[model samples]
Target: MPSIARVPSVPAPGDAAELRARARGALLGLAVGDALGAPAENLKPSEIRARWGRITGYVTDRPSGTDDTEYAIFSGLLLARHGSALTPAHAEAAWHAWIADRAEGQFRGAGFSERGTLENLRRGLAAPISAQHRHAWSDGLAMRAAPFGVFAAGRPAEAARLVAIDGSVSHDGEGIYGGQAVAAGVAAAMAGAPPITVVASALAVVPDDSWTARSLRRAVAVAHRGERAVRSAVVIGGYPWTDLAPEAVALAFGAYAAADGDFKEAVLTAVNMGRDADTTAAVAGALAGATQGESAIPEEWAAPIGPARGSCLPSMAGHHVLDVADLLTPEVEEGVALVPGTDLEPATDLVRETDPLRHNAWPPPDPTVFVLAPDQDEVRP
Candidate 1:
């Protein structure tokens, strides 16, 4: 068997202050971008231009994240509790308890893939089976994948592995690949990897020929020509859904590469591109935030971000991203003995024990799942 290439370990943070800043930057950056881009979701570039004239900053007076920020909180809390021991069953149960079994009004702000997962879970389906619905390829998983990267820090492969576990319940195939790419990229960024190496880390996780990988490569290839060219290269014409995993992932990485990991530029570039605006910008924000640290984000942009409004997942209300950031990167103290397994449970036996490569294998494991035809005029809330 050919040996897998070894990825260099990202050095642990030199001190607690740097760790706190990076973690806070990543989650807070995601929320800021999500709020900034909500108004532009599903709109065309021309329409965005006509309405906001390049969208240099927040467009609404009371800018708050939509489904994107809320879902990240949902996933972040789970990762904080489970750490690397997270399993599909744990994720499925979290879905049921926090979302699926909740009141219908609480589930209002989810995206297509989440809606599909909730419906399947409500109907008593289990994961892998539960993920077998239409719209499984949406960017839902990718949008919330940053916490895995933050937790894994310098371990890109571990980040990819954990995110695949989290994604298995709600997405498959390209959708999973998209989340892996983002997780790997953010993991690399958290470790202080350069912009080019960060992008390389992203490409290393998913198969080269997969739609997510191909779109990402194309977008990065033309990133030097600026955001418009990158958008033109990756976006699917005549496709109604703005949340396709491949397209959204590509656009986000493109924005990251274009800005060379500059928080403001990467986020604004994604926001202006218009398709799946919230997700793309949120992803860009995560990547750039991890690379630059929270202090690097503009004060004005970070100010309005309070605890999530929980428009989507009501249980997540009042749970601030900053609080989650602190949880993921706790302050290191002197003379405090670390206790093992005090907070987290031991790894569950229910975890799938397959080769990690099998998760991203070509032709996908199950091809019988139906692909819904794109409806150009359909708008999802």
Candidate 2:
């Protein structure tokens, strides 16, 4: 019933202030969308209310993550501690740290399907992954991948490398590509590029020959084609009701296409598209948030997207959310190495010749939160 032309507006100018605002806005968008859809996971938006009832408002109190959001937040925490470093040794330390935390029940509340991560941690079977089918390879890797893209804005490839590492622990192939594609979108958005161009950069890393790539490729095509695009995706992209990945991508395509470059429309369109609505909405919202910032998220939705339980950023208190740019300071102490979360062994030889300097990586000042035994919270929150 909505006009297909209702696209969200991009932020004003490309000033650092604007860019930072947009980045924080995107993070908020990611959290909002993530939390909104939390109650609906595998259900269709329609079935969601029946199954879990209306989510009403911030059901959790602060933002808590399923695997997608958790992995991304974890990646951010890793980067925050190390500044901008990505060395193999650092990578190993990170994973070892994550494993130790698991032993201590740091991630005890980790979601259902994500229990696989715990399995991997228990057995130490995860391999060093750079590309394709590295591990679990599920959509979770792609779900919260936008932040990395924002962190590596202006450096799409750098963004991809970070994605490769973060994803190596749990995703592979099209799964990784999904994360890469989304990350590229965020990076380009932060860099102030148009949707058309941002998507193109994302495609460069997403295998143009695969299912994920095919969906995105077709989505771009539909953005210009309209109803026919929808038809193409349903026929080729598959329905989300069948599974979250395909159906989610289909809705993402329609939302992105219809929004043109508008973040709100992009998200709403995805939400309205039905199955996996929450995640589809989140993906579209993140891309849009990256493009437009907090301003792009309609004021109507902002009020309710606050202080949920399990939120990593407890400062949000009980009912608050950060806008874009607020996430950026050019000043968060960028270098600190606490416990590492992912394995660096396999990527060792491959990364040594190409590891980015290890600059940001640290544990939360809340040592009580994670399971890192030997790791004490050196800094206070």
Candidate 3:
């Protein structure tokens, strides 16, 4: 669908090795959170308690990620190919080539925003126009925003800008802002920023008066009191839809704040909150994981994440989150392409130029920083 064009890698600022670890942590943590929260999505906190006494770990015997993880892998692949030159046209084409044009069976578990965008695309509507739907304000974009952060590591503003381009085809207004917040937070975390700084980075990206910003402020303000306080401060009870971008993003940031960037605590808190649990937990997991690195995630939690099942986006099936992480922050040497199908002929130049985000910089500053190792395992742990 969307080809991996010749993206000249420039050397980026910061520790390349550490950036690689954080990138791995962000995507892997997202998969873990998605799998852990899948069984608890949409249920109220009380209902969740009634079903499974505060969900501390994977509920199912064969735990696996949902649409949240699949969609992230989809976005990460696109970012790897296009780098900073990604546009709405590229995103739309990828959507059509990898998703909308395919003869999928049932389109299981996709959110309304995705369905609406696909419908519009089939009707010949372009982006910004394809994004015209009632569910355009959902958390769909936020669910896949982490890759932008990984790609534009250390640059919160750049991460926000890139995610907005990706979201333009399926989200608008608050939806776009929510994605930007998550992207900015993860970007800051990737650079080893602390939790407070991560939150500040998120706030710095969106308009101060926007609903997403306000909700984030309220949630973080009450985060010290714990998840329940954070929930009460931000969540609007009886709102019917749990996928609201503002509410979900707030809950995620609140969980991250409450946990003080602890990978286990942040993810578990988000999972227990119940509203859009998968997406919220995924976002929290990405933020915290980036802050703490891949080693921070529990081995038990990391073990369950395998190649995506691709229940939502079939083209993404068989692709592992680790592989996507490697692709985003690649450290390959010589002519071998990080990804299989792509042709990266200039092996030495590719090795010399590892940072993909360099081209996306405002004035083209310095250079920077994928592929999975042959561990032969389900997860890294």
Alpha carbon lDDT of each predicted model:
0.80, 0.52, 0.82
Best by lDDT: 3
What lDDT tens digits, residue by residue, belong to model 3 across residues 58-164? Answer: 88999998899989988887787667667888898888877888865345439999888889989999999999999999999999999988877777777888899
Query: After TM-score superposition, what is the CA distance of residue 188 in candidate 3 from its true location, in Å?
Result: 0.2
Q: Least accurate stretch of 10 residues (summed lDDT) in model 1?
A: 368-377
Indicate the worst ten consecutive residues by lDDT in candidate 3. 372-381
Supply candidate 1's per-residue lDDT for 103: 66
For model 2 the local lDDT of residue 284 reads 78
- Tell me the TM-score of model 2: 0.67
**Candidate 2 lDDT:** 0.52
Pick by TM-score: which candidate is best? Answer: 1
RMSD of each: 10.2, 12.1, 10.0
lDDT of each residue in 220-319, candidate 2, tens digit only: 6666655335434543233323233433554565577678868766765564444554566677777788778778776656765544333332211232
Model 1 over residues 1-381: C-alpha lDDT tens digits?
Answer: 111124445444344476567788999999999999999999999999999899999999998887888888788777765676678988888888777777644547488798888888889999888888898898999999998888777667777888889888899999999998999888888878888888888888898778988899888999998999989888888888889999999999999999999999999999999999999999999999999999988988999999877678876777788877765655545443222222322212112221111344322344211111110022111
Query: What ranges in model 1 sit over 4 Å off?
Result: 1-8, 106-109, 334-381
